[model samples]
Target: MRLARQRAHALIAKSPADAVRSVFDLMENLPEVERLRPSEVGLVLVRGRVGGEGERFNLGELPVARAALRIPEGPVGVGYVAGRNRDHAELAALADAMVQADVWRDRLEEGVLAPLAAGLAERKADTGRKAAATKVDFFTMVRTRGEK
Candidate 1:
């Protein structure tokens, strides 16, 4: 996934004007890719700043967007987006990693990784809520006969 994201990012950084479309296009053509449900994806708009040794500038924030891609028969969603700034490549790699991982379906690649990659702190606290609830405890519980 990281490789995929990097690919996406490089594609975008090389062509900022068509970054978003390029990402969507690549995902759309990926083999066996499953399109995420519309309700499963979320987006957030944010503002931030970039500070240098001599000056701090307000980098106007655009909507940092994300989409969920459902993996086949897997209880995971891949979150992704083409974000603002020159870190498009890094964000793409992070998104790809999240998507390929098993435990990160609910994660927002666009909101978190994008901003972090761009060297800005996240301005919003809204993480997307899960549409469905599931519980899985990795720890094993031991029981004695009398405990029942």
Candidate 2:
């Protein structure tokens, strides 16, 4: 039997809050908004968090959101968002666009393009330790059964 596969990619800002907010906005204005999911869709609140200043403020808190949407057999889904934390709208939109397979020309403009671009410049100036860890290489040898 042949297998069908769908791929989705979301280039989110370094912040998850931003991702959440954009998703919520899309869900709220589904009808008026361009490149959004339909009304009959549903979404699941996967995760949430709140923190600042190197302190554990709140983690895994299920913030109240507006709606969730899933397209039938379309490999695209969206979640409407709202609440006190109204931050990650742009990231959310980008993520939704990726999952929906709808790539808008203005994705970067509407999403992490500007913020991340500026952030990249700022990071260049700072001498902080690199946030990401480098990969360590490891190799294994396999021997085939042969006349030794």
Candidate 3:
């Protein structure tokens, strides 16, 4: 689920206007929404553990944008995405709210999430193909006792 959200964030961040357009296309109207926390950019400390299981160390700071909003009389949703795109953050926030709304979940998932997932899958497959193109195979030679 986190990976799906991350993918959604990546898709939104890639093109916020498109995401907004898609959202509007899917839903005729949105309930009155209030920003619990307006979209803002900040740095988060990234911690890592050696080999996935060791003492944690501060890796670095990553720039992130986050937004929290709620539909009046409905669930509050939060969006946390990499980079500083306020529009992306806001749209993601809306999607999050819709996801929690249940009523809007199917529409959102079908119209927004599905397309983004498809595009992401396409890009990933393209990358894999390119990587495979450059793949090399190495063979080791075996010597007999009399071989020079």
Candidate 4:
């Protein structure tokens, strides 16, 4: 589920405003979710794990937009997204909330999560391909003199 949340976060953050608006517009039977903590912008101290295994270190502060929403069904979903896009934050919280529900969980996964994750992966692959285009390979060949 963490992956789902991360996927939703990435997708919502990168997607155009119109695309997000369209998703919300076409969404049906969405539970009434009210913001418990209204979307707000703040700075969070970024932490890093060196080499993915070393002790954590405070990297720097990053500006983030966060919101929390409570659905009457059960869970209180929180959205923590990079950048100050309030609408994206709200939509993330909404997706989180939807993912919690039994009825809409699969729908949310299929409709939003899957396609967005694929697009994100595709974008990453394209970036890698573009980068690979300029990559240079270096090799050392053993040379034998007349004695050899």
What are the TM-scores, per candidate, against the unseen true structure? 0.30, 0.29, 0.80, 0.78
Between prediction 1 and prediction 3, the one with superior TM-score is: 3
> Between which residue pairs do clashes occur in model 1?
1-96, 5-92
How far is 111's C-alpha from truth in model 4 (Å)? 1.5
lDDT value, candidate 4, whole model: 0.78
- lDDT tens digits, residue span 43-64, model 3: 9999999999979999999998
Candidate 1 has its poorest 10 consecutive residues by lDDT at: 120-129
Candidate 2 residue-wise lDDT, 22-137, digit = tens: 44454432322343533332234444334434534434444433323333324333433443332243234434543444443244234434454455557655534453344467
How do the residues 58-143 of candidate 1 rate in per-residue lDDT, one tens digit apiece? 55445444434444435333334445432343334344545565554234345333434343212122222332234455887899
Residues 9-54 of candidate 4 have per-residue lDDT tens digits of: 6677776555666767776777888789679999999899978898
Enumerate clash totals for all models, in the order shown: 2, 14, 0, 0
Worst 10 residues of 2 by lDDT: 1-10
Better of 1 and 4 by lDDT: 4
Q: After superposition, how far is residue 130 of candidate 1 from its true place, in Å?
A: 48
Question: Which residues of candidate 4, in runs, are more than 4 Å off?
Answer: 1-22, 49-57, 146-148
Report the lDDT of model 3 for residue 98: 76
Ranking by lDDT: 4, 3, 1, 2
- lDDT for model 1, on a 0 to 1 scale? 0.41
Task: Name the 10 consecutive residues with the lowest summed lDDT in model 3.
Answer: 15-24
Q: Can you tell me which runs of candidate 3 are displaced by over 4 Å?
A: 1-27
